[model samples]
Target: MKPKELTRAIVQAFIIIVLLIGLYQVVLSIQSVLSYILIAAVVSLVGRPIAQLLKRIKFGNTLSSVTTIAILMTTFFGIVSLLLPVIFEQAKNLSLLNVNAFEATATKLMNELSIYLLDYGVDLQSWVDRSLAEVDYSFLPDTINTVLNGLSGFTIGVFSVIFISFFFLRDSGLLERMVMVFVADKNIKRVEKSIFSIKNLLSRYFIGLLVQITVLFIVYTLVLLIFGIPNAVTIALVCALLNIIPFLGPIIGTVLIVFLTMTSNLDASFASVTLPKTIYVLIGFTIGQLIDNFLTQPYVFSTSVKSHPLEIFIIILVGGLLFGPLGMIIAVPLYTALKVIFKEFYAHNKIVKALTKNI
Candidate 1:
């Protein structure tokens, strides 16, 4: 390569590396506040419709925004109030567990597994011994402490979300108008239409999520109860809510429910219960998943956002690759907004035409 060309390439590479490092540091600095900001954004989007309705009815913007915040807070705490007692009771159950018996049972199971694997020429016992020898039991206590501390830290973030959401909801209309000023005078109406469409679409998307969660909770609770799973309420609540995360969520939820079913409340009723409780648990979850996949998701993605299922799936995968789980969670809404903006500004570009064709 020529000297000048090499030097220019080197400078560009150096700039890119510095920019990436700076971005990483910025992310680390804002990690705590990012959660609050995301909460505010979601609340503002969901409350936008109700605030508009209030405006139509002649409610003052400040009063309507405050009322919307109150509604969101009350709904959040109402769910928390129901869930907290269940969590506390389960913690009490954990504290009362017989540790020695638990250890003995685990050891016995490991031995039996070792014996079974002997027929296949695998020495599971040796592997278990090696793994146990290297295991750090102290990590368990440290992990528990970290989780408790993290939970306590969120108290401040919760209040921050509410306070931030109020300003966002109150001035949301003004902000929308302000944004339109950046567009050419002739194209301002196009930007306004795009913004209005985004708000309406996102509102439906969020309302659809609440409906999905409620439906899943009811279905999961009923299924677990029929199988006599202990802590069905808490498990159902957790499993249902986990569906909020994209792609990987339902798998995590199902695995957790299966583990709880296998470990809790063993007896003749469990053993002679027609089918193994584990199998029953799987069956129940499979049915619930079918409902979610066939009914809930289609309504949320297709009807609410007007995106094809395959399109939504690909967007989620790309988002997960780029930005991790949070990226996947927000992928639909972000993609929708981008599509609208592109259609508004780049209507003549071929790629833009293809991407925003639906919108």
Candidate 2:
């Protein structure tokens, strides 16, 4: 290539690279704002049906929107209020925990296991002692302070989400109008159709998720109570909430349940009291998960989102690979939105047609 031509190409490439880097930095700066907007969008979508029902009953748009937001706020705070006391009490107990007593119990359990495993030449009690000796209790206070410090930011985010959600609920087509600003006039009708379809599907999908959590919460609570576990309701709520993250969530929840169950009765005999209780609790957790997997998940993925189970699984897996848990949580809704857009704008593509056929 000529020197001048090569120089010009290099300058152009440099400019493009600079522009892309600037754009990325801009996105990083405003990510919190973007998160608030996105969360508000989900809230608005979930409350869409309630607003519509109020409208059908002759309520004005503003009144319906306000009422819907009020309901959502009440429900959110109600759950928080119910759980906060239990959480704080548990935290207090943890802060006042008798570390020596806990260590003694643990050592006793380890000794039992060591005796059982003596045939294999494993020194379990020594290992447990070393692990316990290395633990630092000082971090707990700092962690609590960190959480307290974050409450201010959390409050700001909550207010921002509510402000955005109020506008979204009041103006049902606001998001559609925002999207239309970027589309060509010729494609306006198609874009509108896609937005409408996406909203309808996502509304149902989000509601289905709520139902799934509620079902799991009830089942878990029943199981914990039947097993006479301490703070059963609080534990159940935490476990149920974790299921919001797709495939990996239930496994984590199961581990958490088993750990908490065993720890709650740490002073008891490992082979008799603690171990048997943990096993029973695990059985209950398994039954709850079976109901969720077989009944709740299928309806949410298939009926609400109109996506095949295998397709949803693949998308969630890819999402997790790319962005971890947050991606997996949003994978289905984002994929559903893309499917609608593809069906509308790229109907001629055989792949798009097949993937979006149900929609």
Candidate 3:
């Protein structure tokens, strides 16, 4: 290469490296604020359609933004209000169990399993018992207090999210203008198109999230009711909400439902049964999960993110491997955003072309 060309190449490389380093430092410094910002952005995305509807009706942008936020807050607090009673009742019932039926069920199951496993030379029951014996069971109070203390911070973050999102929604052109300031004039239109695509996709994704949760909650509740579980509504609501977290969340929620079912009798109004209704609970969960896996997930993924189910599966698996549960939860929306951007800016790149062809 000519000396002049080599010097220019080196300068460009140095500039790119420095920019990357500065970006990393800024991200690190604003990590806490970044979360709130992301939350606000999502809020803005979800509220966009409503804001647009109001705008079409001749409502001012600021008024529509506040109204949308008000609706969102009301729905959030309404659900929280409903959950608190169920939680309090669960705690009360647990405290009242002097000789818990759940413990009896566990001991009985273990004894039977121990006898069955003895033939295989694998003592699963004893191992479980030993593990349980080692658990502390004492820090629970301190943990509760710590969570209570953190409520203030959580409240602050909530307010921050609402505050930022209001501005985001009120000024629909604000984000576009802000992004354009950093874009070259030649690429500004492309960036604007990409931003529009992202907003539309994310809006559908989050709105579909609410629809998914509601459908699952109702289905789960009805299934549990058929099995004679007294706290069907509570369990179903929690499990449905947890489905928002993706794969791990559903599994954890199902396990929790099973445990709760194992503690209580199937007959809420009749004579108390000695044994836990494990079999019925298992059946209900199996059917409920099948409905979730086969029905709800396909519709939501296909319609919301506009991606194939298999593609979403691969992305989520990669996310889980790279960053665990949190990564898996965010995998779809994050991938969709990146794909949009890449389609706009790197359309010539073969891999980007392949990945974004469907989008």
Candidate 3 ranges with C-alpha deviation above 4 Å: 1-25, 53-59, 100-109, 132-153, 263-276, 317-326
**lDDT, candidate 3, 129-175, per-residue tens:** 89999999999999999998789878999999999899999987776
User: Count of backbone clashes for each model?
Assistant: 0, 0, 0
User: How many steric clashes does model 3 contain?
Assistant: 0
The predicted structure with the larger TM-score, 1 or 3, is: 3
Across 274-310, the per-residue lDDT of candidate 2 in tens digits comes to 8899999989999999999888889888889998888
What does candidate 3 score on TM? 0.81
Which lDDT value does model 1 have at 288? 89
Candidate 1 lDDT by residue in tens digits, 85-161: 65675566567767777667667777877899999999998987899899989899889999999788877888888
Show the colliding residue pairs in model 3.
Answer: none
Worst 10 residues of 2 by lDDT: 85-94
lDDT of 3: 0.80
Best by lDDT: 2
Error of 2 at 268 (Å): 5.0
